[model samples]
Target chain A: MNGPYVAVIGAGQATAEQERVAERVGELLAEAGAVLVSGGRGGVMLASCRGAHRRGGLTLGLLPGPDRAEGNPFLTVTVPTGMGELRNGLVARTADGVIAVGGGWGTLSEIGFAMRLGRPLIAVGSWTVEGPAREPSYPTADTAEAAVSWVLRQLG
Target chain B: MNGPYVAVIGAGQATAEQERVAERVGELLAEAGAVLVSGGRGGVMLASCRGAHRRGGLTLGLLPGPDRAEGNPFLTVTVPTGMGELRNGLVARTADGVIAVGGGWGTLSEIGFAMRLGRPLIAVGSWTVEGPAREPSYPTADTAEAAVSWVLRQLG
Candidate 1:
């Protein structure tokens, strides 16, 4: 059985932190016995996969197009949603919780979708602050260890 | 006047790379005198905004919820789309070209939306790989420079 599933959304076009963050997130998800989900690319998503794989956690990459291989190597389950960017909402909505790292337009869309769908999100590490009526904004942690710890508290 | 209006979509969470990559991309856009569009939170979008602002570029953040102030500090223009996650497609389609950085579900959705809408996307870093004619795949890139360069070539 899956422990907990979390969806991570961010920029694929990034090079430095994007990739590093994804890898760290992936590792955290694995260690936490959680499944990591991403758009299935490089940078943040790939980094997430690397983290998950290193810890032997399950990783899922939802592809925007027909090809499944477009996902990162760490993905254990790859869902090819031939939907296109329209699927961004679906992906965000499908997750139990979400985390927004540094983002672009794509990441913002997911944040919007998650909020609209009323899912719990942990905006950590200099991300956005939560507004009123939603869950209280958790502490912003710089390292993945701190971020994952916050996620566990929220899940609990 | 704007050179070419483009939208960047990806995760909002942060890692070490977020600031640098966002700044670099913003610099490039500013050099071209283009308007930078994003989800308007933190991480890459904020970095992008900071970069654009430094060079006196027009930065726009398409916010999801009601308050535009919830956007990044660097945004010169903030469009509060009460549309929520569904509006992600609008952001994707709104741009002439879409760029992907390190991202998750929301980014994938944008890519999916773009693909379905037949829009152009240039993926960089490891976030994901986008091709107009095929299904979406996530390919990894080690650096932001490589990802951005690949995107430029793909756009050409």
Candidate 2:
């Protein structure tokens, strides 16, 4: 089923735990019949794409470079942005919601853009962003199960 | 003097202290006879552009959208990329060096891209990037004076 398409933003180079969480998150989302979207590089992005693809779920990668060669091996469909990492904004902005795993600045930038766009942002072992006291900065979850469930709830 | 062009990446929604640092960085870079480049939006980018313009230094803003209206007030020239944040890569890649002030994720992503391309990255109260132990993740500067000096030294 072509349900809510969610984007997962993380670093191309990630720690083992981060990669593990990303794969689990992707698997859960695919099992739920959700379409997967990622930066289409490596680390969490690659893991998510692979998880979705293996489960027969549709996957899309919004690649930054002009060529698809830079994309990860798991992407089912790659859209060459030729924009570079600024494509982070496009990945987050176009998604219905976002799941941020352990990441570096690139992931943070995507989070910033998603937050600014008022998209549903769920951080799983990711950055702790604090905003004004009155405003909401988004939510954080402890595990992949919690993150994917939250995304589904948001789509529902 | 057209000595060099340095990019300053930081948060669009910045604190007074962050903005002050960014402005000072711009001023110092301009005083050194170097051109300033930024995202050309609000917060630190706008502050930097303003500082450069007030100092009679050339400033370029790589704006995201198709129009120049989104650019900061002090920009001498705004090149609309229409590539959205993807222009961040262009800004970082084209600059002689990058000075990162207090910023959010967008700034972080630029840092990531710049580092991957082996551009000298100077962090001023910004991200703590970690890479291979043998390679310098990036250098951190305590003040705008130090940051600008470092960029100049790199160019020299």
Candidate 3:
């Protein structure tokens, strides 16, 4: 399947659990030739960036404010959207699929955006999204391998 | 100062370093009686939430998609903007000053949006916006207290 950019929406600061998950997910995305897109900050986004960078993947950070320099160091390209949390939907739509790790309202919003845009979405521990039909959202393994496997199936 | 509701923008997954900063910032915001606005996810925003929540201050989350259920538990009010990342600027603009913590492109975009709107901005923890301003960009601080202090001065 053609590579797709997947947006991972979550907190800027990551817990140890999140770091483990991000590392695994990063490897999966890199191997599958998918780009990881995030808010370009710390927390889950940065953990994911570190994972992706280690795996030789391309990581894009969609910064909300105006400065490109504020992005996480791992980000290969930083898009200073000059937007705010409102742009969260754009970040979700830009991706073919979405992976939401443990997050708060921002991650929740991105998941909602993914559903609104009809993008395939996968949730790891503590993050979930549903379709209009009231179908329960699919829950994936916390590890990167399981998450990527599910994403590949959706793409297929 | 009018007790401005400053938007703290960043990713959800914060690192250890970020958590320490977040804790400090939370205390400062609480003491300053400033309302914290964010994407309403985790990370720096949540840390702000924890700080503000303790003092019973206001916390607003402008989510990306439609479901308020996806918002952070700490969010006292959740606005479903449904605009995605494109609305990032709107979030930044809703506040009088913007406080960015360890961020990425999304945070960068928030900074950019703040700059474009000519609003005062504060950066903490190496946010790229801290660099010497080519124009009338605001100042930067190593910690959240200093950033909030700087923002209050700007608002004044």
Q: Which prediction has the highest lDDT against the true structure? A: 2
List model 2 lDDT by residue over A25-106, tens digit each. Answer: 8888888988788989998899888777778778889998999898888887899988767687788777998999877656
TM-score of each prediction? 0.50, 0.80, 0.51
Candidate 1 accuracy as TM-score = 0.50
Model 2 docking grade: incorrect
- DockQ of all candidates, in order? 0.07, 0.21, 0.05
TM-score of chain B of each: 0.81, 0.94, 0.88
TM-score for the second chain in candidate 1? 0.81
Off by over 4 Å in 1: A124-139, B1-156
Candidate with best DockQ: 2
lDDT of 2 by residue, B5-99 (tens): 89999888888887898899888888888878888999999888878877888898999899988888899888998977767777887788899
Q: lDDT per prediction?
A: 0.67, 0.81, 0.72
Q: What is the DockQ of candidate 2?
A: 0.21
Per-residue lDDT value at B70 in model 3: 73
